[model samples]
Target chain A: MSAALKLVDAPRRSVALEVRGVSHAFDLGGKHLPVLDNIDLSVAPGEFVALLGPSGCGKSTLLRLVAGLEQPDVGALLEDGAPITAPDPSRILVFQDPTLFPWRTVWKNVAVGLEARGLLPAHKQRVADALSLVRLEAFAQAYPHQLSGGMAQRAALARALVNDPHLLLLDEPLGKLDSLTRLAMQNELVSLWQKVGFTALLVTHDVEEALLLADRVIVLSDRPARIVTEFLIDKPRPRRRDDADLVHLRQTILATLGPVHD
Target chain B: MSDIAQGGAVRTVASVPIWRDGVAAAAAWFVAAIVTVATPDVVPWGSTPLWAEILTGGAVLLLVLSGTVQWLGRVGRVVVHYGPWLVALGVWFAVWEVVTAKTGWLPKPFFSPPQGLLHVYLVDTTRLGLCVLFSLRLWAYGFGSGVIAGFLVGVALGWSKRFAYWGMPILKLIGPVPATAWIPCTFFILPTTFSASVFLVALASGIPVAILTASGVGSVNRAFYDVARTLGASERFLVWRVAVPASLPHVFVGLFMGLYYSFAVLVVAEMLGAKYGLGWYLQFQTGYSAYANVYATLVIMALLTSGLVKLLFVTRDRVLSWQKGII
Candidate 1:
């Protein structure tokens, strides 16, 4: 109900994201370990895209690059045609863990971005709006430990949403959640994106999840990952997991990732 | 993890009925009072009418509290918790009185009855009061300045690698040496004995805090820093908001250690060249072998130090309330 939360009908200024020839590697005790291979992708403003890959296929590393927490060694990431150099409040990343500051309450955790930018005083109401957006208003003062897994993840989402980010990079944000919570949050995520209209790039290992949530799903190969295939899902909002088309897409995507051991 | 089970567990811890422990405590205290008044000392240690009165009064008060404490709400809960301790204290007091004054088993000058301690309290209240005030003043100044300096130095060492590179080796070298070991040098360096004593207390307290704080800050989860950075937090923000809060549990560990060290150094330092501290009073009384005064001062010192420790605990609970159940 707060002013910061735009109605679904209202126009939102989400940013266009461009990743060009991005390649990155980590040094593991003096040995070169490649994670992300040369990868190029672009997301339209207000679009929802999911990157699907095998576990440890550099999907999260790619999200980190897009978040500007780390720079890709080979290429540039841009937001709205401007090169991403440093982490900005406009581009927020939600990790697998809630990572809520244990010392802070849910409300305080959500206010971190605004507080860090010195804008909390002027926009305190946004924190409350963000909490309620994720249906966490009743637990605004509760500590992270007091919250259930789903509630804590919701609080983490609110922490990102409070900044009114243009692009949200989700690095398997619901990976640690139970299946029931994950399904509920997947619906919540879709509705939230529709309402806030942020350009979202989600990195997920679940093919069904990618198929269920994203307008477009980009599949990458195993470690030193490069884009292997892309799928365009024209399904309507509130798409069902069992829908024939989604089931077909899931199977095809899984097939492309090669045989699953599990 | 089940809330219902946890609630049941709590509900099962039933409060003692009829206040049996309280009654026992009152009975012991009454016996102590009777023995002090009715029996003559083996060697007429001192007239202790006031001590007898106090014991009688305490017994009567305990008896009354036993009857009425159930109606006192929160205070009653606290009384119930310490019921066993109260009973032990009463029994201990009676036994102590019998051995020292009634039988003279623990002979003169070497040991005194409880009332001999009480007699010291009644006669030398002014001197003890002055000593208490002076000791507290020195302790406050030393502990305050030392904690502050240590916290700053620790933060610097923790946050900046450059600072740690130069500071850590020096800290390792100096930290192990006893604060008292510097006493001779400190007296020569500082202009006054008071300053020297303060310096010793500060050194004893500061080193532990600095060492623990540095380690605490160093060991904070790196993920927290990453999370803060991605949230648009500045370098300063990361250090103050993320690093400091995350390291607080460790800092508190340091603080507790510092508190104990500070107290030990305070007593030792006061013994050196002070004019009017509890430590000074202890030394002065011992010189004359006024064992009664020394015993009374030791009791006061025990109460003061424990009171400070309890105060620190209260402060810690308030500051770290967020961490109540989590860690």
Candidate 2:
């Protein structure tokens, strides 16, 4: 908690990101499977946007491109008008799986980025605060196997958050949680976003989640995904689950998902 | 109803300390002591039948130990719990004595009584001690160098695609052949008999370790690497921290196999050329028809192997305790 407070007291350091004419495909053996069309998007500093898409759509591919893990076949990803040629600690991505190093305790997993960058000695307290932010300070010494699904996701979130990242790329982070935990995590995520104020681009299949937390939800079409539509939510904080407007928007979005392929 | 209640009260007498566990163990040893003293040797007593004295002495010791079992702490308590096995051991000794020495059902020239083996240990202590020290030194150097080289090569094979492509084919080709097959070439290739013996032991131990370690490293989930990479881990960190740690269970499996193979190779290699090892002592005793000394050396070798195996198990449990609940 002290580290987060100290970080807040320091000057803001979040950077803006821009994705221009980005298109991507993956090589499956000798075959090329096109996943992302030439899509353009931009995220402002401190903005929270959700990329909502169908299951096999190219939402995750787009996130990876912006993360610099994969380069787009065409066009480029720029952060603050500079090209992202490699993965940097300034931008971090949290995958659907917690992906916690099983041999490490929760504290060590959160400290991994700091240790890798050779900054552990100067910023040890930040690991504690990151765990505290996830309400898992009590479990800092515990292994990932000891934690429940929701707790593991929280630890993953803390791992990204500890970098004090300018841009946080979330790839369906809460997808594996039970429905009750999912609802609770949705609220926790919104509150954490409000507190830290990092620019978040969440890729999720949950329509209601986007409506509840995201400032703007960009829905993509099927495979070779193109941006089909976007909805801007201007709701007040503490939005209720049973809010009429949210239910109406959810119905409209579900209809847009189309009929099941099966 | 009152009569039944009185019957239940009478059943509590079964808890009497007179009928406790140590009683049976003590009784069995007493019977063994009496048998040892009374039995007449069918063959002329070699070296004064020292076993009867040892048996009497052992019975006395067990009685004292069992009496003070409470003072033995946790280990003593466990020993007392296994009192029945001790009782069985006493009975087995008596039966073996009656069959071999007393009745001569199994005669000498091939089999010797327990006293004959004990007499060898009592008279040849210094020479046997030297042989043990020499064997241990050779084993330590051979197994140590073997495992270290194998582990490094395994890591390279598992981590690098190019290395695996070239090295794996050779490893697979040479792996199935037994270490003893290399003895002829090793004797000519190395300068000394000891060096040749060491090479044999190293080859026997190193192959399994290298093969298993490569497979273990190769089978690690690719997702772990991706996770570490995104966490800003350098290439070196990914190989050492992620790949190596994740593949440890397999490495341990390799180590165990390698340990057994090395022990087998050690005995064979010592027999072929070494001058001062337990294997050499066994061969020398056999040539002199001193079967007693051969049996004594075999017992020593068995104990050494088991002790080393127990130590390895302890180390594994400590390092891999993270797999406790899951495994």
TM-score of each: 0.94, 0.93
Candidate 2 segments whose C-alpha is farther than 4 A from its true place: A1-10, B1-21, B44-50, B64-73
lDDT of 2 by residue, A45-141 (tens): 9888999888989999888888888788998999999998878777889999999988788999999988888888889888888898899999999
lDDT minimum window of 10 residues, candidate 2 chain B: B10-19
TM-score of the A-chain for all models: 0.96, 0.95
Best by DockQ: 1
Ten-residue region with minimum lDDT total, candidate 1 chain A: A1-10
Off by over 4 Å in 1: A1-11, A260-262, B1-18
Q: State residue B281's C-alpha deviation in candidate 1, in Å.
A: 1.2
Interface RMSD, candidates in the order listed: 0.9, 1.2
For residues A1-262, write the lDDT of model 1, one tens digit per residue.
Answer: 4443443434577789999999999999999999999999999998999999899989999988888888899998999999998888889999899999999999999999889989889888788778889999999988888999999999999998888788999989999999999999999999999888899999999888898899999999999999998999999989999999898877787788888513
Q: What lDDT tens digits, residue by residue, belong to model 2 across residues B71-140?
A: 7789887988888888898888778777777788878756676776777888999999999998998889
Question: Candidate 2 - CAPRI tier?
Answer: medium
